[model samples]
Target: MINRTVIVGRLVADPELRYTPNGIASCKFRVAVNRPFKNEGEQQADFISCVAWRKQAENLANFMKKGNLIGLEGRIQTGSYEGQDGKKIYTTDVVADSIQFLEPRNSTGSTQNTPNYQSSTNTGGMYQGSSQGQYGGNTQPNYSRVDEDPFANSKGPIEVSEDDLPFD
Candidate 1:
């Protein structure tokens, strides 16, 4: 069975970070995903609850805020618990395995109070790259130049003969 979800959306509110009694970090937040089609000339969006743990959680709470675009990859999780009124309370959320900040710090329209966190790449719930001790030190990935294209030096297109066709 496959259980995975990928979502790219804006945050509905600031992430709330908390720690367990054992000192493990966790964060919860909601994401607003707009529907592809318009509903009565107005776009609709779904508010999804998500949870992140450990370093990912800390990073999210410290760096992300309402209206910031983010990308996440994770699995859907559901559970139920007994309420104080003796009723069963059901909960569903995405347990994010990885998260990426889709926008630059200054582009999110955030105010001056937002933490000036340097974004870093995360994979498989693990922080990757130089986090400057905020998220622990990790080796950064070497990225190639974005302006250079490998196929830019291609010559003129060659003419193809009908004899080279596989199906005719």
Candidate 2:
């Protein structure tokens, strides 16, 4: 049997983190996912219950809060327990294997001190060039800081050799 699910949505509320008797960390939260279709010119969203464990759970509780955007990959879990009324209460939730923050830490407009974390899955090659210095320093020169283009004074077409071509 195969059971997998992926969701990208905003959190409904802050994650609730707790430790078990064994000292294992766990967190429970809800995500509000907007439906693609609209009904009566109004968009509807589904509140999905989710749970995360261990370091992921800790990270979620510490760094994420209500109204934050997030993406998660997990599997559906279902269980039932006896309620106080002597009735079985069925429960369903997504067991989060990985949770990703979908926005910058400062975007929420809060002045709290928090580390700026970017999704490693989509860094846009920010750390690609070099292994030295902070954030994988780029080997390329600081061209963006230049006030004017170096080629702006050139009077004619620049000449290039066939050997300079990177590809055919």
Candidate 3:
């Protein structure tokens, strides 16, 4: 009865963020996950659709772009609708509960046109970053400098007898 799924992959394109009529934030993106095994000497990859909501959606759209590596936990969702051509279209997507950026802020690969996003562990445990023109407002976090070392006053290495060693 469990429907949980976890995956780590690179984004195939930038996440698209949109607001519902009620002003709720939502994002949609695709991830390219490569298969561990090769098929006839060629690597295979599957493109998965994913959706996120609330602050997670906003953060994802603002900070992530194509070629960025990310890990996500979610549940598989499926739905169907009638298309304009009178055909039933079935869709499958991952409804993400949480996402973790696997790479450092500066390591987004190959997609140079992507915006720079720097995340910090502030904002009540939410990943906050400066929103590019796509999103509005920028609240930079205050970082404190640690100029003094607590061990600066310590003497040289302490001497220990063989009795302190648990093994020979």
Candidate 4:
């Protein structure tokens, strides 16, 4: 049985962060994902309920806000609970395994302030601004402008050590 889901959308509202009695953090939020096709010339969106736990939950609650674009990978979870009206309430949610902020805070369609997040390597969903910082390096990565060639300074063949290769 394979169960996985990926979604890119905007948050409908601010995430609600809570803690379990044992002091574990959890966050609940909704993502509004637009349908690929328009209905009657109007865009359609689905509001999906989602939950995040541990450091992921805390980071999301602290860094993100309503209307911010985000991408997440997770799996669907379903359960039922007894309601106050003596009825069974079925609940469905996407338990987020990782989340990426698609845009910078206070800006639309901008990449500034956006953290470089690698979901595969970062299960905790915490983005540390850059890979160098995350891997315990003090040096910052240099980003060249579009008109500038990154290899312009090279005049000879680049040296590559065997250890630098991904495979032997």
lDDT of 4 by residue, 22-107 (tens): 67678999999999999999999999999887777888888788887889877788889999999999999987877887776665
Q: Which stretches of candidate 2 lie over 4 Å from their true place?
A: 109-168
Candidate 3 lDDT at 153 equals: 91
- Per-residue accuracy of model 3 over 7-37 as CA lDDT, tens digit each: 9899999999999786768889999999999
- lDDT for each of the candidates? 0.75, 0.73, 0.74, 0.74
**TM per candidate:** 0.69, 0.66, 0.66, 0.68
lDDT of 3 at 140: 39
For each of the candidates, the C-alpha root-mean-square deviation to the true structure, in angstroms, is: 7.6, 11.4, 8.7, 9.9
**Could you say which candidate leads in lDDT?**
1
- lDDT tens per residue, model 1, 40-108: 999999999998877778999887788888888778889899999999999999978767877776667
**lDDT at residue 39 of model 1 (Cα atoms):** 83
Q: Show model 3 residue runs off by greater than 4 Å.
A: 110-168
Which candidate would rank higher by lDDT, 1 or 4?
A: 1
Deviation from native of the Cα of residue 12 in model 3, angstroms: 0.3
What's model 4's overall lDDT? 0.74
